[model samples]
Target: MFRYYFLVIYTVYMLLKHIKLLYELQTLDPRLSYAKQMEAVYDKPKSFMRGCIGLTGSTVSIHQFGKTPKGPVLYVHPKLKLADLAVLLGHLDKTPSFFAEPRAFRYPLVHQWLNKMGAIKKNGGEHTAVEQIEEIVRKGQSFILSEADGIDYESLSSRLGVPIVPIETSGIEDMQKGSFFKRLKPADLDLTIHRAYLPENKRLRA
Candidate 1:
C-alpha cells in the first residue's frame, strides 16, 4: 500500500513539473519586431483591423494590429501553410498570443508526420489545442485562434461568448503570377481578416 501511494505522489509531482516546463518554453518564443516595419510601409490607418465578424468571400492583405486595443480581441486566421503562418505570427502586434491547435494536428501520428516533413512548425504558444485555449478565452484573455474557415469561427464565438476577428489569407494573384520562389516568400504575401458585421454596442464604439 505504501509503495502504491508513493507512486501516485511521484506521478502527480511529475505532471505538475511537465506543465511548468511547457509554460516556460512558451514564454521563450521570440517577439516579431517586423510588425512595426510593415505598418510603416503601408501607413493606411483605414486598413487597420477592428474587433468584428462576418465578411464577404475573403481577401488577403498585410495586417498588423497597430494600436493597443481595449477589450477582448480574438484574431482568427485560415493559416494553412506552415511558412506563411510563421511569417504572419511572428509579426503579430500582441505578445505571447494563445494559439489553439486543432486536436487532429496534435495527434501523435499526424504530428510526427508533419514534423518530419517540416510542416509542424512552432508559432510561440505552449498552451496549444482547442480545449486549453477555450479555457483561456473564458477567463477573458484574448488570443490568436488557429482555426480556419467560417464554420470554425462561428463555433468558437458561440462556445466562448466573444467576437472573433476572422483573418483570411489568399494568394490568388500571387499564385497566378507563378513565381515559385516568390510564393515561398512570406514577406511578399498579404493577410486579411473580415469586418462585415459589427455588434450594436461595438458599432457605437467604432
Candidate 2:
C-alpha cells in the first residue's frame, strides 16, 4: 500500500513539473503568448490610429488582421498579393489621413523573403497555431479569414471591445490564380452575429 502511494505521488509530481515547465517556456517567449501580447497592446493610445483600417482576404492575408495601430479601426477585403502591398503603400503615402494595418511597406514576409534570398535565418518562430492567432487578436488587430464565421473575429471583438470589419474571401484554390481584377469582389453584404455583449444601441450598417 505504501509503495503504491509513493508511486502515485511521484507520478503526480512529475506531471506537475512538466506542466510548470511548459508554462514557464510559454511565458518567457512573448511571441508564444498571445494573451500577453494582447494585454500589451490594449489601451495603448500611441499604437492606435483613428479611422484607419486594414484589408486582406483568407490564408495569405490572415496575418493582416493581427496588425493594429491603436484607435477607431476596420478592415476591408478580397485577397491581396505582393502588388497589392505596393498599392497600399502608395495609398498610405498619398493619404497621411489613414493608417492601414499590416502596412505593406513593413511586411514581415517581405523581410523574410529578402532574407531567404540572401541566405539568412528567416522563418518566424514555430508557435502553435492557436497561440499565433490569439497573439494577433489580443494585440488589438483583426483578421479577414476564419475557418468558420463565429469563432475568431466575433469572440475577439467582444473580448477586446473592438469592432471587427469582417470580409469574406474565396477559398485558397480560387485565390492562387494570378489575375488582379478577377480577384477583387464586393464582400458579402449581409452578415450578423447575435452576441450578448455587442452594444445594443448601434446597428451594423451595410
Weakest lDDT window of 10 consecutive positions for candidate 1: 45-54
lDDT of 1 by residue, 1-206 (tens): 33334434653454354444333433333453333322232222112121000011223456534343444556766655533444345444442233324553565333432232123224434434455556545544556656542235555665666665655555534422234323211123466645422332343122
The reply for model 2, stretches above 4 Å from the true place, is 1-76, 85-109, 112-130, 140-151, 166-202
Global Cα lDDT for candidate 2: 0.32
Weakest lDDT window of 10 consecutive positions for candidate 2: 45-54
Once fitted onto the true fold, the runs of candidate 1 whose alpha carbons sit more than 4 angstroms away are 1-69, 96-130, 146-151, 170-187, 193-205
Q: Against the unseen true structure, what C-alpha lDDT does each candidate score?
A: 0.41, 0.32
TM-score of each: 0.40, 0.28
- Cα-based lDDT at residue 4, candidate 2: 30
Shift of residue 46 alpha carbon in model 2, Å: 18
Model 1, residue 193: displacement in angstroms?
A: 4.4
Instruction: Point to the candidate with the largest TM-score.
Output: 1
